[model samples]
Target chain A: MGLSLKTAVAIIEAALARGHELRLAPLTVAVLDAGGHLVALQREDNSGILRVEIASGKAWGALGMGIGSRELGERATKVPHFFNALAAASQGRLVPVAGGVLVRDASGIIGAVGISGDTSDNDEACALAGIAAAGLVGQTGARPAEA
Target chain B: MGLSLKTAVAIIEAALARGHELRLAPLTVAVLDAGGHLVALQREDNSGILRVEIASGKAWGALGMGIGSRELGERATKVPHFFNALAAASQGRLVPVAGGVLVRDASGIIGAVGISGDTSDNDEACALAGIAAAGLVGQTGARPAEA
Candidate 1:
């Protein structure tokens, strides 16, 4: 099912709340539909200016490859050249790092969320918290063994 | 003062409401800070996937040049070559059209809003309606006489 604006906003609110609770830095969050179109986004005041693009890029890359950015980060190390090419092809929107998670439902993948501002792992934690808050599943694209 | 996420969402909500009232096509709206960075954005479902980029480009161009895309469009007609070069230089982010508008407070130009997915004029109308809805002034970059 397509992600509604309400749900996207809920996810953003929850994500930011998690950041606030953890006393992390101000955050930026982006929710992208399956087609990698922005459904909703918010950049907290005083967040770095580039946070929005970086957040959206992380989610866009995850949605584009049907994998989470964490897994993509791992792969980037094995084949740096390929990941570089991918970044070029995607117009520098493929940010292969943590904080990108696939939003899933019983049907399949519905959308993705990306967060930025804190450490990659902390950002990913917020994403997962937000997804759970919205009663959806998040996949970080971890291999089954690692997961 | 900077463009707060709250004000940005208010603009998007009012813009979409205007579009719905007029029965216009699905619209995508983007809000950008004075630094030409995204503050918030939303694309209505079924709107073209490229709407996000187009909307952001429209606002980005306005903030980059300190004028609205409507004026930019006028200039593009007189200097096609210059405008073409500008497009290339911005990495294809400058979109000269009617829908981009500057958001102003009493202090000065604070940010910009862009709308896409309908005729450019209609898109601009929605942007104006939104800015007004938020109790802010919108500058379409129309010449003083035309305005």
Candidate 2:
């Protein structure tokens, strides 16, 4: 019912490769299936332990809202209380930020990719590049530069 | 990093088939990745709404303790407070019962499979058989009837 683990791992690898290419800080990337479950996760050396959790939170948030984290983040500004309650409801597994991007296949959103450790825009860029490298689409919305 | 969604689904299908072969009650099975996030889930028709949640809780508990739920269940009797706190920390996602088993490949523990909607022993047996069908191992501990 969602993206394959092989593809999910590919996305994380490609995202890490982009981080290396761009000389960004160490990053952690998490991929989640359509059910908002972790498929594959990778943390580059030196990425703090919390980065992985944060990345997972972003991906979970994107999957939960069926939108890119950027969109969710924007929505949070209008309904901070709601988002806060959601955060509590989700056991703090919600991170509405720019780094979470929906991964879409030909059918629709198969899953999501999330990145942490760099600037939010750059993290989202890495996530998008990673998804693209895997021959999938990423929903980056109105974020800034790609890389 | 985790079980592939494909393999997870395969495990559930195999478990469901086993349930039919054994003529047990309707069942719900859940597969979770190494990080304890649900990868795939299947609730047979007429299975209670709580079946999915129960399956997830069992899988989560197995993964959390790095042991089969059977063993965890045994431990829970001796140290109920610890298990209680764990359940709270996990937002009520802990079910240390016989139906939860670890999914392992040659490398190590890849994920976990959990079943509900029937007797715990029957549920664990189905989980073990399903893992075997998928060419993976299910850590059923020393629990009786299924090994």
Candidate 3:
């Protein structure tokens, strides 16, 4: 099933609230359904004009690659040229960073959340917090522990 | 000054309310600042995947051309080749149609709103209703009355 607007708004609100509690800069949040289409977006006042695109790119990249942006970032370092080309292929929508996280449920991934306006790690933390607050599992694309 | 997130959200809510009263199809609304940057956007559940981009394109065209998209449509009829080239140059962001309306106040043009998922005329009507509900002026870019 697709992500509902109500659920998307809840994620954005909780993410913003978490950012506020952490005293981060003004943040922008974008929620994208599994199809990588925008369901909702909010750009805080005084945020950069490009923040909407940036936030959406992060989540879109995660959804497109079937992995969180953190893992994408890790891969980018090993294959910089390929990632650069991928960015061009996606019309600059693929942002390999840490702030894009996938939302999961028993059925599978339903959507993703992307945040901007702080350290990438901090942004991802907020995303995870928001996902948890909404009672959804967040897949951060971290490497699994080896035996 | 730029439009605040609160004001943008209010416009979207009121526009959706209008659409609901009229029983229109699922709708998408986008608000863009004078710089043609998205401030906020929402795509209702079951709306087409491209609804967000279509809505954003309409509002972005209005902001970029400094006129509501209704006027852009009229102008496009007179210069089909030019309009086609303009659309190409804007990377498909320019949508000349009736649903895009400019938001204004005593200070001047601040932003534009675009709606989709109904007849263009009906979409424009909803946009006007929303702007009025928010206590703002709406410019439909209609032809001026001749003296």
* Predicted structure with the largest TM-score when compared to the true one: 3
Candidate 3 chain A minimal-lDDT segment of 10 residues: A138-147
Model 3 C-alpha lDDT per residue in residues A1-147, reported as the tens digit of each score: 768988898898899899989999888899999989999999888778788877898898999899999899899999999999999999999899989999887778899899888899998999989888888888878522122
Q: How accurate is candidate 3 locally (lDDT)?
A: 0.88
List ranges where model 3 is wrong by over 4 Å: A142-147, B142-147
Write one digit per residue (lDDT tens) for candidate 1, span A75-101: 999999999999999999889999999
- Per-residue lDDT of B1-147 in model 3, one digit per residue for the tens? 767888888999999999999999999999888788888888899989988988898898888788889999999999999989989999999999889999987688889999988999988988888888888888878522122
- Score each candidate by Cα lDDT: 0.90, 0.82, 0.88
lDDT of 2 by residue, A24-57 (tens): 9988788877777656566664566578678989
**Residue A30, model 3, lDDT:** 94
Which of the two candidates, 1 or 3, achieves a greater lDDT against the reference? 1
Task: Please tell me which model should have the higher lDDT, number 2 or number 3.
Answer: 3
Better of 2 and 3 by TM-score: 3
Order of quality (lDDT): 1, 3, 2
**Colliding pairs, model 2:** none
lDDT string, candidate 1, B1-147, tens digits? 878988998999999999999999999999998888988888887888889889999998888788899999999999999989999999988899889999988788889999999999999999999988998889878522132
